[model samples]
Structure formats: C-alpha cells, structure tokens
Target: MTSDQYAAATRSPTDTDVERPADRSTEPAAIAVEGLTKRFGSGDDPVTAVDDVSLRIDPGSVVGLLGPNGAGKTTTIKSILGMVLPDAGTVRIQGVDVAEAPRQAYARVDAMLEGARNDYWRLTVRENLRYFATIGGVAPDSVADRHDRLLDQFGLAEKADVPVRNLSRGMKQKVSLASVLASDADVVFLDEPTLGLDVESSLTLRRELRRIVEERGLTAVISSHDMDVVEAVCDRVVIMNDGRIVADDTVANLRQGFETSAFRLTSPDLDADTLATVRDRFDVTDATTREGTTTLEVATDSDGFYELTALLRERNVTLASVATVEPDLEDVFVELTGENETGHDGGDSR
Candidate 1:
C-alpha cells in the first residue's frame, strides 16, 4: 500500500480532530534548524545549552535524539518549539521562521515536551480528550468520535469516565500521547515519550509512533535515553554530547561501522602447550583458568577470526563456539563522545 494509504488505515480516531494539510509533500522538510544556540546565566557563569547545532528533519521520518544526561537535546527541542529563545541562530517549521513568526511556526508543530501532560483532576478521561480536541480546533461533531477512538486505541476505553488524577503513571502517559495524536499536527516532538512506562506499554507506544510516521507521513523528533527505543523506532539518530552534535547516521550504519570481532571461549581444561598456542595466535584481552576450565575473551576483526580459529584447532584445543559481538548504540555513544571517561560529564539542559 502507499504510505498515505497506510497512514489512513492506522490513523487514530482523533487524528481528524486537528487541522492538517491534505497534500503533505514527500520531499518537504517538516522542521529545520540552522546554527541553533541557547545560553543561560551571565557572562562568566554563562552556560551554552545548545551549541551551533544544525539539522533538517525530513517530512515523514522518525529521528531519534539521543545522549547522556545534560546533552542539550532538550534545549534543541525547546528552541525549535520557541519555548526557549535562542541566543543566536534560526528555527523554521514548515518554512515559517519561528523566530519571526512564533505562533505561525508552532501552529504547524505539536509537541509533548518534558513535564507536559494532559491531566485534569476534575475532568474524566473522555472529558480531557474532548477538551483538548476542542482546544485543538476539532469540530464539535468529530470530538466524541475522536475521543472514542483514542480511548480504545490507547486501551483507556474503560477509564473514559474516570478522572485523570486516579490513573496510574503509564495510563497518564498514554493519555498525553493520545492528546498529542489528537492534535494531528504535521510534525510532533516527543520528549521522553516512553519514560516511566512498563515494557508492554512502551512497546505499544513505539509501534503506534512508527505507524504514525510511516503511514501518516508524520515527521517526528523523539528525545530518549533508551538505546533500545532508538534502535526500534528511529530510522536515523543524532547523538549529542557537551551541547554538540557528535554523530548523525542511520542505526544500521552505526552498527556496521562499529562492528568488532570479539569472541568468548570456554573449555574444561587448558594444558601448558594449549595456553602457549592460544597466546601465540590471539591477542587475548582477558584469560582466566579456574576449576579446571579456561575462558578467554579475544578481540579480532572479520579477517582475523579464521586465523585465530585455525591456531586453536592446530593445538587440539576444544572449541565451544565463536561469534562476533554485536555493537549497540550505547557502545557507539561512548566510543564517539568519550563520555565514559572522567572530567567530561555534561547535563541535559533544563
């Protein structure tokens, strides 16, 4: 099916509650930032929250914003949404300059920044949805229809009449997402959308976000600490550290670029001859022999695995198994930023 058709099929009921252009272009960028910068405090104590960051989010892509705590991801989002004024640089939403036309720029983008939630102690879940729908300019006749759909899609149908204050944290987060989906903006900014959610809920939300981006052609900018979340949901990721964009690449490319040939071996016994053979053949990072068993962790590239294996075989050493260790985003983050070392810690901007 076509992308638009897919989006329409999986669209939430409240999707029609907000105003959106019917002719979203495949090539048009939903948001763009050039030389974006934000500073805090006075001259001597001034801290740069965002440092000359430049990025362009495609019209219908899900881009993951990842970093350790205090990496300026939040500051970048705030600048894009006009929540925090930039000391310098420019932010444009759907071709509208945010600095020059804040309201018009933000009108095309709907966001759920950190600490932004849709909860009214006095209002029921349905009431809250309806209220947000109205505020988002959904027509009266469509509000209830959209509300029913969101309630069911988010698995909150049973709690429709229940007040928000009584719901659990996960349920509240679901409500907040439903509210944003109800807005139906072309571009959505999700700041820690899955934070504090259970595994099942997190999975559900990730699936929904993917569906939204792929089917509806919605552009999304997601800020998250969970590497697994970025791996599963984002097509590409931008890593930040010390208020700078350290890396930007597809997850697969990053994985392949950082692939390491590492192996773990276990054996019941190790003779002196076999130990000598192993040492001559492999650059062993660690070797431990205990309880009449030996285990070794060795690092090699693809071309060297065979030679290492051949040497072990020549010594009549018993081999359990050899496998390449897969590199994760966390490993790449550390390798690129060097943040794992001391004296280089940074905080996510408030």
Candidate 2:
C-alpha cells in the first residue's frame, strides 16, 4: 500500500475515545507527516532514502530530529518542507496538505534547510530582508518596521548595509534566520543551524532560537546531530535510524529511562579478593590501576547498589567516593540506536 493509504488505515485515536478518519478535519497539528517514504535511483539499484515514517509535531513545541548519516533525517525534513516530494506520503502543515495545496501548506511555515541561501546576494543585508518581506506578502510600508526589528533581534543592525557575499558565515546564517522571522510563519525548520558555527556563535544562535519559540509560541523542528544542541534547546527528541523512528520521548524521560546506579570507586590499596566478591553481585565493566589507585566501574540493573556498598564496607574496602551516574540524551540515543559501536556520523558532533 502507498504511504497515504497506510496512514488512512492506521488512524489516530481521538481524545473522546473514538477512532476517526484520518482526513476528517481534526484540529491541525503544527506539522504532520504520515507514512512518508522516498526512494532514489531506479529499479534494482533504488535506495530508500526515507522509509515509512510518521510523526506529529504539536503547536508551540520544539522537537529535535536526530539520526546518524544516511539515516533519512534530512530527507524527512525536506519532504515536509515541500523541497523534495515524497514518493508516497501525505504532508500536512496547519491542516493544509502539501500534495493538494502546496502554497497554502507552505504558508504556515518558514524554513532554513541545510543550504538555504536566499537570492539577492548582491543586495545589502537590509535590502535582502526587504526583498524577502515583499515576497512574503508584507505591505510595502510595513517592510521597514519589520526589517529594523529583525535586524536588531538577530544582531544584524550593524551590518544592515553590508552585502551578503561580504558577510561572515555566521552572519549569513543569522540573516537567513532573520528572513524566516520576517515571514511571520507559525512554524520553522532548522536543519543543522549550527553546523559550521564557532562556540560563541552557536551559543548565540541557540539562545535566539529559544527566545523565538518562547516569545511567539512558534513550533520548530530542528534536525541536528549535535546531542548537546538538542539537549539544550529541544523539548523532546525523535531518534531515527534506517529511516525509521527508534525512540520518541521528552529529553528528561529519555534520561530517566536509562538512569542506573553506576558508581566509580577508587582505592589506594587494590585487593583482587575484594574485586572477586564484588563481581559476583555487580556487573563490573572496567577496573584499572592508575597513580596508586584502583578504579572500579560497576553497573547495577537492580536496587543492589546499597548492598554492594555494604559488602565493600564489611570488607573494609576504602571507598573514596560514590556517585550516581545520570544518563543524558546522548546515552539514550547511543543505547537505542547502537550507533556508538559503528561511530556516529551525522550533521555535527557535540
């Protein structure tokens, strides 16, 4: 069956505890992709860039789309934005289907794809903003007002008169973002926004994104490989592998799901006999001697951490310190996708 047919078959449950038709004009999500699939090349050599994928992004939420290289994150984003047509899928933006009404669907969103560079490179920054504002259907008299505000918001007021070609990479990115803001769309798609930015610039961009989402209730789908960036900005994350979603959860929930009472123990006097006793109860992964101190890394699947401590205590094992190891989104991603063993290859490393 085609992607749309699959979506139609698998209906989303309503809050009223009833199953409704997929195209029944329900409350529109900020962005929705149903059973999206895309393939490239031809015949026997065809590669499925994006497999059967379905996602619903609520309004006013910031979501991260994460995956390793060749995992179809970019393809999914592009298809949703109408930049690349999915072979079989239905893309809805604010209740409008792109397959049926591309213009109306795209009207609800403004996006910055991996290499989204606006035209008018010869025009100055301010001029380019004005040009895009006009294209976005802003009134002529309102252009200057919107232009000034975006310039200041994106910290481009100083370089308003500078030509786009003369702007730094970071500045160019800011300008692209400014154009999106000028469009006054309800949703934004940022694909690797901090791909090539320096530390300071990346932080600045992240702060701006947070401010934009909070101040305007703007929904966003950020596709990036940088786990730190996702952890810092996204409210929830959707992890994809081989064009399929492996995990979808809030950042906090994901961390909590993987949380374990793993402890790092250090001792000046090493005891092989004590180690043997501990191994019987704990899953000891690493033991090393460094600088006269033997470090033990132990992982526990149950509530035996206190027992382990008591066992050490009974043996007079010198416990230097005990701390719980908290899991982060990166850990969850690694555990779910098994990408760490193969080495992660995606947008940018954190």
Candidate 3:
C-alpha cells in the first residue's frame, strides 16, 4: 500500500484475532497473479515466453522478480502490468482485475521501466513530476506535498529545476523515481533501477528503497539482474529461467537452503587415473596447476565430499587444502539456470 493507504489501514482495526488479508475487495490487494502464460510469435515458431507462472505478493512487502536474458522475465512482467496480454492467467493489483479494469488496476501502480524511458527529456525534474503526478490522478492538494517528500528522500531536491537532458544518469534515475513516488501508488514496479548508476548512486538508491518500503509501507516489484541490489532491497525473490520459475523464496532462506558443498583440492603431480576419477566423478568446475601441483575446484552435494576424500586417499594423491566457500546468489543462479544471461538476450548477464 502507498503512504495514503498506510494511514487508513492503521486507523481501522479489525475486531477479529487476526486482521483479514489486505486483498479484500474493500481493502485493495497489494498484488496477485495466477497461471500466467504468454506466447510470442505465431505458427511453426511460436515461442511460449511465459509458462503457467503464479505469484501472490502481500502488502508492504518488496518482491524481486529475477531471471537471465531471454528467460521470459521481461515478458512475464509485461504481462503482469498489462503491457502485454497473456494467453492465460489473471492479474490483480489492489483487488482490481487488470484485464477487466485497466484504469483502476494501474492507478495503484507506478512503474519506472527500462532506463529513463519514463521521463520526458525536455521537462525539468519538477515539471516532469508535476505532470506525471497529475496524469496519475494525484489530488491537486496532495501533489505538492508528495513532490517535496519524494524529491528530498531520493536526493533529487538539488536537481529539481534542471532539465532531464542536463542531469547525469543517476540524477535522471532519481528524478524518475521521484515521479513514481509522487503518485503515491500502492505498488511500485522498478526494472533495473540501478542500471548505469555509479557505485555510490547504486548504493544510495538501494538504501533509499529499503527505507521507502519500510517507512512508506509501499509494496514494490523489482525486476533486475543486480543480485546485490535484489538481496539488499527485496524481501522475497522469484527466480525464473526458460520462461518458467525455477526458484521462489526469501533471500535469506534461499541462500540457507541452497547449500553448495564447494571444496578446493590440491595435489602434488596428480596421477592421470586419479585426475580422471575426480574429473569423471565430481562436478569439477575449475582446475589449475602450478609449482608442480594441481588444484581442482569441485562443487558437489553433502555425500559427494566423503567419496571425494576416500577417492583421493586411495589414489595416492597428496591432498593439500580443502575449504568450503559460502555461495552467493550469483553462484546459485549460475548453478540453477542454464541460460546464464540474467537480463536481456545474448547472455551478457543483466
């Protein structure tokens, strides 16, 4: 929910032990999508871009929708926002059906899609926000206050009067974000929000987004290849691959559950038979030889380590060092997805 809805929900308390979910007809849904399927092209080469994906996002939560290039992530999001109609499935934002009621469904959502594509190049930052706010149906009285709040929070106050053409990519991004917040929409959709941002700008925006969701209580759906940003800003993540969701879980839980038994093994002048055994048996991800010693990087599950040690001892290979390394989301993603590319096409990972 947006800042406006946040106050109203608090003012009215349910008499029951637990408050009914925020998705009731009267309350408005944060987000809901079911059985989403979409196909692009036609005839012999019809591409099924999305295949039976379903997700329900709760109010006051941030969900990161992640995937590799051509994994149908962009297609899935487009369908959800009603930019493209799915062959099947439904989308509901704040309890309003997007298909049945486009205007009502979109009113509660503000999206910053692609790179600065949402902002007008000729308009000043303040003017752009003002214009979009009005178009988004923001009340005339609340528009000024919303603009002021967003500009300050996003560090766009200093660049308020400058035209979009004169601003740096980061400044323009902030301006786009301010325009988004000015509407005070219940759900905000940001696709690659940190693209083209410097280290500092990326850090600043990521920090501000976390703060925004917590303090403003606005739901956010972020689609990005930047796992660091996703880990920092999103409460939940849905990982998709090949037009289908491969993994869906919280950032912490996914990391905890996906145990990668990775070990580095070094041996003195590894024998061919032993080398063949390790190569053939274990998932050897990397190998290097130096100073009369060869090192093998093996990635395996819980039981594989025992087999690895035993096999090494029997082969007379002098094992030097073995260490377990904690796996991050990028590593997890690489193992889980075949496409590898995380954003657009051609495998240059988003």
Candidate 4:
C-alpha cells in the first residue's frame, strides 16, 4: 500500500500488560468505537483520514471492515488498538477506553496485521509464535501447547522449524495468523488476512479461521478487499468511504436487502430510442447492442418486471429473453465504497 493507506500493527503489549484478563466479562461489546476522528498534519492542509466513525462488535462475532484506499479503515483499526491516537472520539475494548487505559484494553486483544509486519522474519515459524505468545502474555508453561496447536491449525506442522525468511509468502502469512491465535486473546483483529495466496490457499485459510473463531468463541474484526473472503468469513460488515462509515450489516442483508432486482433484457434487434423509451420508466445501468441482439441491464424490484416487459412490448423491440440478476457481494462493495480499486487492499501478496 502506498501513502498513508498502508496498514501497520504498531503495538506489542508486554506479558505484564496482558496475562490477567480485563474485568469486562459483563460488557456487551468486545470492541466499541464512537465518533472516532483522526487528521494528519495541521491547518488548511490537514487530511482527515478517519471521520466520525462509530461501531460495536458483539462478543464471538466476526465482522469485516471494508473500504477503498484512503478511506481511513487502517486509521480506524489503529485507533481502536490505540496504536494511532485520534484527534477526537473514544475507542473502548471490552468497556476500557484505549486512549485512557491502553493496557486494560489491549489485554484482551491480538492482531495479525497487514504485510506480515507483525512477524520477525529471522525467526522460525514456531519460534515466532513462541516469542509472540510469551510477549503477548501467554504463560511460559502453556507456550509449547500453544505453539503446537497453532502449527497444526495452520497446516504448518511440517514446516514448524523453518525460518520465516525461508517459507513462501503464503506460509509466512499463515504463520503470522497462527501467532495471533497462539496468543489466545479474547478478541482478534485480522487486516487483509487473504491478501496474498492463490484461491485454494485463501479458501483453506478462511475455513481454518472460521473453525478457529467458532470453536474458540473468539471475537474478530477483519479488514479485507477480498469480497469472497468477507462473504465467507464475516458475520457482518462495516463499510467505509473517504473516512466515514457508509454501511453496516450482515453479508446476506447487504447483498439481498440493499439491492433491487436487476434485469437483463435481450432482443434480436433494437434501437437506441427503444432503450430511451424504457429508460423513461426504469433505472438502467447499461444498455448495449452486440451482433444481432440488444442487451440492457437495469435495476428494479419484482413489481417492476411486468411494467418493464410491457414497455419493451410497447417499444416493439421484440424482447427475446428477460432474467433477473441478483446483486453479489462485489456489486454491493463497489456501490458502497464508491471505488473499484484501493492500495490498502494488498501489498507484498503471496
């Protein structure tokens, strides 16, 4: 990621800073952010990277953070982790304000962040997990068990002794994530967990993550550009645009609830005026005539189907076929984030 969109995991809590869990068992939200705002620089040139964003995560729920580059998603997560101080607003982890009580808030959390920046490349896979877990406050006696569990869960059992530098990018990515789980934190934050790797690797890791989160009853907040990953792993999503939250809901609701039925009308022959005539009564995303057929894709509800088809008949376009296209996660993401590309989505991918 270029510019300030680069995601960074800046905090490394000591064993004393963690170990004992925060006294937040009764808290409803594992992570709570309210009216968060951050601006870099000063005066007229100030860039507001996070603006008035607020969200809450129920315990044991997995939520996705999505947005275009420079949308302040990275800044928002850093704010929650207390790695980046905000210009305004409050971030509370399990009822403890991060800015006011970083130790208490951080005690319950572990993060596998972007670019594998959280790992020590010179260390072996198992060594990195051991070090991170101990430093993050896992007990010395439990380190070996944690290490072995992480290696097996990540399918790195065979490469447990391999140095981080020697493994492929995908293997290293798995190691990075395994370290987060090894910490045994109550809350986990994964920034672009599927940024690297091929489709198969991504699928495997996502499945493992789901199993881990569910089995452990862990609360997780994941940031990613991979819509498929979000759809597969997240219970809900909070979408951002230009530093502000635009949508927050479940994937199914985001895909089905926010969308109107879009229909594609095909005809053997058609005229531009015919499309214009249909446009008078319906919303059209695109209409193109290729070869011997004209195809028009338009947004409408079920009730509008009869009206649209009848209009086509009135226009004499000889509608050959008509079918509805339901919006997918990708379509919803683009519509909400308002940008198709983002640098924050990936860097040094496997």
Off by over 4 Å in 4: 1-27, 140-143, 264-323, 341-350
- lDDT for residue 222 in candidate 1, whole number 0-100: 86
TM-score of each predicted structure versus truth: 0.77, 0.75, 0.75, 0.76
- lDDT string for model 1 (108-129, tens) is 5777766665456678877777
Q: Please, what is the whole-model Cα lDDT of each candidate in the order they appear?
A: 0.74, 0.76, 0.77, 0.78
Cα-lDDT of candidate 3: 0.77
lDDT of 2: 0.76
Alpha carbon deviation, residue 155, candidate 2 (Å): 3.1
lDDT of 4 by residue, 88-176 (tens): 99888878888777898898699887854878889988888888878888874676875787688778999988888898888888888
Scored by lDDT, model 4 comes in at 0.78
- Which candidate's lDDT is highest? 4
Ranking by lDDT: 4, 3, 2, 1
Ranking 1 against 3 by lDDT, winner: 3
Candidate 3 ranges beyond 4 A from true positions: 1-28, 263-323, 341-350
**What range of 10 consecutive residues in model 3 has the weakest lDDT sum?**
1-10
